[model samples]
Target: MTKSVLVIGGSGGIGSALAQHYAATASVVTVISRQKAPTQNSWHWFEDTLQSPAHSAQCVQLALEQRPEVIFICNGVLHDAAAMPEKTIRQLDTAILMQRLHANVAVPAQYLQLLFSYITKTAGVKVVVLSAKVGSITDNALGGWYSYRMSKAALNMLVKNISIEVRRLNPSAVVVSVHPGTTNTAMSEPFQTNLPPGQLQSAANTAERLAQVVAAVQPEQSGKLLNWDAKALPF
Candidate 1:
């Protein structure tokens, strides 16, 4: 039987791809975006509580009523407005950084907690979030985009913790953080210069790879950070 799926931040490049890929198979697929989706399958809402826990929690609270079988959190941020950008600080746009943390790390973490009941008692439920390759604390060779990196790293931690807790609740459920690779999204458009062949993918291809990865993820591998190819990532 088909199950419900929710794509958080479905307005994003990779997130949009996810909506197209799964909407056909899922019982009902819903997307939450800042703006309305071009298709009728989604519903748009304002995400103003990006910095406050209570506000972010409210958004997730609303989603809980739908009881998504899988949730893909594709939200993120990068500061292009800073007068100076550094690998270590990124100019410390306090408001922007805080917003990034709330969106990238805290909001997803809270939603996992809020949606715990949906996946815990249900079978075959999955929660997937987009994490960046730079988020790996052990894998940070370039050493730039501090806020984005740290927030993703925190997201990984959140997934690991959730997986541990879910084992006691639902054995069929899996929660994982996936890096969708560098794609041709507005977020990455600025960095597409000097790109390597096949390294930069279209949103469609990124979505395809992500769907394949999600299809292949095993419950035994729950709590792990993985790429679209199913390879392991450093937490």
Candidate 2:
């Protein structure tokens, strides 16, 4: 039988590719885009303003009406605002951290909170959020990009908590965070050269790997972190 899938940021690089990939097999492929998504299936638009508590409360009310079986949150922004040698702790702006949190952490946090009822009610629900490897607590051998790293770390915590809560409420919905690897997107284009040879995963490669990650999840595996290749990660 055909299944249902919802992609929160289905307009961008990996998200769009994922949307297209699932639409081929899923009977219900829903896309919530910042821009207009393809009209072939169910599509909706959402603005970043939904990150605010007041707006997100309302947006969540509306989204619950969709009754999704799976929810994939693919929203994130990585602005390595200060490059190396450009600034130091003495010159760092405190406000930059807040902006970074809002973009990568706060927004997705709000979205996940708002999406509760649908996720908890749906059977075999899978909620996957796009996170980064740099956020790994044990894997931080090399360190920089304080804002970006902290934002994603916060996001990782949110997903981990959500997995527990969803398991209690839904029992069928498996919530897990995933690291998509160093991808060749606008967000990582500036830093790709620093990546080891053949290490920077293309958006399509990321999406394909992520699709496999999605397929690999089971309810018993909730609250875990995984890489795109289906390998478990250290939380």
Candidate 3:
């Protein structure tokens, strides 16, 4: 059967790559983004943002119509034009922290809340939220980027909490947090220096790896934080 896939941040690097990859097998690939997709004809595009409650509602409405088998909440912001990650405690600012929280934590949680209703018990569904290894509280050996780390940690918690409820409602549905590793995207462009050789992967490569991870997930594995290689990350 042809799959129905939904990508929330379809205009971004990994999101676009996943949309392209899934389009080959999906009967209809729907992308919800604030910007226009480069390859407009490859998938159905819905111009929207999850910045506000109204937009979130619209997202749920659109997604309910699609009833996606695989949904990827790929939206995230790291060092955007308005703010960059704090290098030290003294550099931390409330405004920047709030922006990061809104983008990284609140927005994605809201999307998941609204979209969960459409996932039926009979249909096997997977929801993958792009998270970071830094989000792991137990893996915080190199502590920096306070706001970004906090936001991702909160997002991970949200995923964990949502997974419990989702499993109760739809046993076949799985919600997971994924760390895509360091990819060659605009988001990681400013911090690509001093990385080990072959550490940075292309968006297409990361997308393929992510797809494999998603495919390998089972309902019993819901709520776990998975690395690109499909190993469980420490909470």
Candidate 4:
């Protein structure tokens, strides 16, 4: 059967790479992003206005109409033009925190909720969200990036809760979070100096690795956080 794949945030570095990777094999690849890129399959241009719940629901409805077998939510924000990751508690701003929550937490969860109605109720659906290792509550050793960390942690919790509900609703459906690692993307450019020599990865390389990880996940493994190598991470 021809695979149907949907990639949200397809304009970003990792997201673009993922769309290209899947377009090479997937029967139909639908990409949603702020920019309308020339795609191998289809494109859905998203607007910032979709951040509103009602607007997002419409966007989700449009995507669900595609009936994608695999959905990858590449939406997330570590930093932006106005704000960077907080290095101390004093740097925590309500506006910045709200932005992070909307991007990393609310948006991803909205997509997941809209997807539930369209995914197979049996077992064939797979949903992957681009999460971060810093999101792992038990894995936190170094403390910083308050807004980013808090938002992602919330996202992780949503993934866990969604996984349980999905398993009950559809025995074969799987939902999990993934840590793509430190890739050479615009989002990581500011932090690249901190990474070791061979630690930084190209967007294409990370996308390929993550594709493999997604393919290897099992239904029973739902709700777990996985690294790029497919290793399970602690919640």
What root-mean-square deviation over C-alphas does model 4 reach? 2.2
Could you tell me the lDDT of residue 229 within candidate 1?
92
Per-candidate TM-score against the hidden true structure: 0.84, 0.85, 0.94, 0.91
Q: How far off is residue 24 in model 1, in Å? A: 4.1
Give the lDDT of residue 75 in candidate 1.
Answer: 71
* lDDT of each residue in 1-235, candidate 3, tens digit only: 4378889888899998888888876557888888955653867777775457787688668755776778899888889777778879999999999989988998898788778677545468889999999999999998889999999999999999999998888898889999999999999999999999999999989988998998889989899999999999999
Q: In what order do the candidates fall by TM-score, top score first? A: 3, 4, 2, 1
The best candidate in terms of lDDT: 3
User: Which ten residues in a row are the worst by lDDT in model 2?
Assistant: 80-89
Q: On residues 137-156, what C-alpha lDDT tens digit does candidate 2 reach at each position?
A: 78877767677777888888
The best candidate by TM-score is: 3
1-235, model 1: which lDDT tens digit per residue? 3366688888777887777777656546666666644644444343533556576567666765667767788877754554223455636667766777876887677667667777788788888878877888888878867678777888888888989999888988988989888888878888889998989998988988888887788899899899879899887
Candidate ranking (lDDT, best to worst): 3, 4, 1, 2
11: Cα error in model 4, Å: 0.9
Taken over the whole model, the C-alpha lDDT of each candidate is 0.76, 0.74, 0.86, 0.83
C-alpha lDDT (0 to 100) for residue 85 of candidate 3 = 84
